[model samples]
Target: MIGRTRLAVDIGGTFTDLVLSLPDRTLSTKLLTTHDAPDEAVIVGTRAILAEADIDGSALDLVIHGTTLATNALIERKGARTALITTAGFRDSLEIAYEHRFEQYDLYMERPAPLVERDLRLEVPERLAADGSVLLPLDEAALRRLADVLRAQRIEALAISFLHSYINPAHEQRARDLIAAAMPELAITLSSDVCREIREYERTSTTVANAYVLPLMSRYLGRMREGLAGIGVTCPLLLMMSSGGICTVETATRFPVRLVESGPAGGVILARRVAALGGYDRALSFDMGGTTAKITLIDDFMPQQSRHFEVARAYRFAKGSGIPVRVPVIDMVEIGAGGGSIGRVDPLRRIAVGPDSAGSDPGPACYGRGGTAATVTDADVVLGRIDPSRFAGGKIALHPALAHDAVLTDVGLKLAMTTDEAARGIVEIVDENMASAARVHAVENGKDTAGRTLIAFGGAAPLHAVRLAQKLGIGRVVIPVDAGVGSAHGFLDAPIAYEVARTFLVRLDGLDQALIDALFADMRAEAEPVVRLGVPTGELAETRTAFMRYRGQGHEIAVPLDNAALQPDTLRQAFETTYTQLFGRIIPRLEIEAVTWTLGLSEPHVLPRPDQVAAPAAAAVVIDTGRMVEAATGETVDAAIFARTALRSGATLLGPAAIVESGTTTIVPSGFAARVGYGGEIIIEEKMA
Candidate 1:
């Protein structure tokens, strides 16, 4: 009975989506997000989905959730009042970030505002060497004095970051114990336990971010659990991770910092799976939601992973302009181009789309949500691309007149252009913004956009995929059935997984076997319980990796560890091989050292195999008798609007057509054709000349 039902939820800036899976059917619903109380949207959406599916909450086997709350909290500066406790001379480390300007050429470029001001950052005298050797012991009296200062200042949470804490952590641990003994109610985060990396600024910034959001995330998660239990849903809730894995609620609440990019990671997972289904090994995932558009590259069915990501960039596309968090995250580029992105005309009379959005409360002009600003969606409606009566599966009717009036008054009349021209300009500007982001991301990763097929998803992706693909010179596009709720659907395909990282400094010359074994064992032990919470007994697999580099290098690369017990020499050879593969050559004289080790456990599940699919009947051209419209060149073209549910496998249709489904809409341009594949995915392939 428990295996008969499952639930997945994804919370975005403008919408919260819920999906319920029964044995034979899936039901989904979308609701406006409640920013004031984030869990309220989850409760409402979950109830609606379960009711529509005719299932009781008690029968659910699993609940997977992803949300933007943590990311929003950091961006809006709405986290808890937090203080930092650090070694004496390092009090200014968080404030004084890497002393490099993000924009070297601009004379007036401003740096990102520090999260924690100087007054709140208290110092305790302690030091540790880079090799885990204790230099100056932590002073309990000094810690207590700092604790008193924090208490007097009414700090709600505290972060403990010490010099060389990733290597030793003894001083940070002792400081945490002392702080907890003194202040029982204050939440605490230790840098060594959270990140366990070597960069001082990045590690401390990550710890501070965790501490700042700890209280808020803890309270929200606790309330959500209680609410779900009150409704008789006794199943354990798991959360998606930024590293493209899933972990238990306890793990999420303990390390909420890792959830910052979780939602976008889900979209990447969907794109990768869709790519494999369509027989494309190299693909670009393009997701344009209500507040942002994320672009990620995938090869061999895996999204790229990175150990560093920045948020709230002062310069939109600059790398070093924001707070750096060193965690395992899927590598992607996020730009502020989305449905709710506001469009305006600059003083030079050039049209510009957003780095600012009219969020759910005051959505685009056509939503009737009290917004007066023109947005991308409003532009689409005015350009005759979106049907007002059929938007969002007819759930919300849009007003075209309001969109026209907003654009004409704000942008059109001033620029001496017609309303349609202004709307087209807005669409073109956003498309170029997204294209520029994709180009930059590919260049940074040593990839070429022309060689990768575009896998488009998210609420606004289908509306613009054709134009976007054309801009990038990409030859093919694949739009899945549930593109609007793609991230939520991706949750169903995720395996139950967890990753544990710990610092165990080992110089390759020394080769400490006993220490290496103990460190790996500790990491595995820490990761097992979290993995077991989602997976049943005796059905789990694990992967081991060590972060290694040359002796004096600034960064490290992840090397795979063999499942069999590692002999010292064998391990050294493995490291040498991995180093060469990553850097093209190994260091001739310097030794290789491992600074950190990670162990990941996952209960693997098989996705539906596409290669095993039986080909359907010979494709037949079906004429759509609904309506005719211009899709691309503004020339009248016969377009068919077909119901996606009625199209079976092998059903083919030519372009300029609109495929409408319950959750999303796909528009095929004039030069392409679509066919339903074996697994019910809509595959859009470009026609040859």
Candidate 2:
């Protein structure tokens, strides 16, 4: 059967990528992201690619999209005027976040500012018991007055979180009803709806964050859909969630906070798929684009995931120094070390790279688009790693002299170094920065990074993967086909799904079977409409997980549970087994209780398994080439250059060579040799001693 025609769009900080899968082939492109409009770039690229493929946009049966607009809005503090309505005495929950400083030893450490200011955080008279019983009746008169204040203040969005509302959403739902009656135009998010788990601070933070970005996301998505429709493409539009799942545009408009890591999450999903196809059990995903780099660890062909993550960190590795958004997300470490990351000299005359980026407006100095400052991409050109004439598949030519001037003036002058030396420093430092991040992420998650194969993708990853692999002592690397537009491609393969979770504390000894059944049913009901929107005719797959731990523990671990009639004894055994795997021991004499239950509904993935086959052998030959400086030494030499498309399977190539492809280049250093795998993967291995 012919494949269905699909299109996937991923909007990054610096670029908007489009991937169109026609019945016969795949087409892709990258264009500068229109920060002001965001969808303008998508429309232009869509029209261009569709015309290039000699097809009309109306032929598309589906469209998938992922974007960083929500994440950027929160980090830049550009969200709408938002207010938080909480139980009367709990208005300070956001201010009293975590209590312990993430950087305990620092004398001047600061916490992330709350998205909603104290003045805007209003209080209403309401109380609920630990069991979700109404301790005090909700004061409707007080809520009406608060509604008036909110309207007078011109609040665009509102977040409502009442104490113990996770267990009983009655109070929160009533407040929402009252607020809607008064301000029907207001965008509101409830903690009970956004995050139905315990922990007031995290739940409130998540809800407030959702409300903060709701209006912006809703408007942007609406505009984007209209823009796409105007171009003759009329199909079901899906949004990629940070949890590596796809949902309808309606679901995305309601809970847009789940999209903070959606772009990177797509790359991880692509990596996992490639690894499974290549028969690799362990792989490290590295995605480097124009404005940021992301690294994730994949085990057993699944990307690691988490329910809690921090954003906009004030301190790079400090846990509590960033705003926490408790939503289901793939676990990864991201830093501003991409091609367009600006390089600067600190006050101490030391070289520093970003957390800031030039993005796509003017781009790098070499783009000849008016960017004056030096960036990582400019440095690569100066060092000869990038061929000026073939940058961006020859669509845009780079100016070598401009790269030299920018690096020399911005870095060489301050450090008393040559253009080559400064460029080398910038390049080496960023590689080290990415490597260091990968190491830390692995160590924190109790994972080993020593021998994992680096599955690299995106526009800039292949350019740096080799050096990064050497730094982390990795022995192999895989650069897949169409690596430049990998994330957008991954979006085409994502499952249309939604996860629903609720907090209902229950001990195993006295497990309430009836309550468990009802809870799961309700969650499934909530998720079904979202899932059916994308997979209307397919058999839905359901997954169940319970967050369990010792009663005294502050955090819980997720354990998979049978959705059918599960016995209490069997559930206890499963939880204990999982606890042992994570902690290596089970706490004796401790009562284990489940704090949160989750149910996920999605279209079942029927991906083909990789064929286990023997490795192939090859020969070394040189073709088109470029002169590049050795990263270890400043000496320039002839780096062997070979076209990735020309090399067939089982062909072996040596290091000190450049594997050239569209959108990216893999530098094979002297110590490594690449072997082509049967699955179209370029596997680089360390040469034998």
Task: Report RMSD for candidate 2.
Answer: 2.2
Q: What does candidate 1's lDDT look like per residue over 497-609, in tens digits?
A: 77778777677778777777787788888778888876668767778888888888887877789777756677678888866655567777778788878887888755444
Clashing residue pairs in candidate 2 (N, C-alpha, C atoms within 3 angstroms)? none
TM-score of each: 0.93, 0.95
lDDT by residue for model 2 (564-621), tens? 6767788889999888866678888889899889998888876558857856666546
Candidate 1 lDDT score relative to the true structure:
0.83
Residue 178 of model 1, lDDT score:
89
Model 2, residue 427: displacement in angstroms? 2.1
Local lDDT at 592 for model 2 = 89
- CA error at residue 249 for candidate 1, angstroms: 1.6
Model 1 misplaced regions, further than 4 Å: 1-3, 504-515, 560-593, 618-638
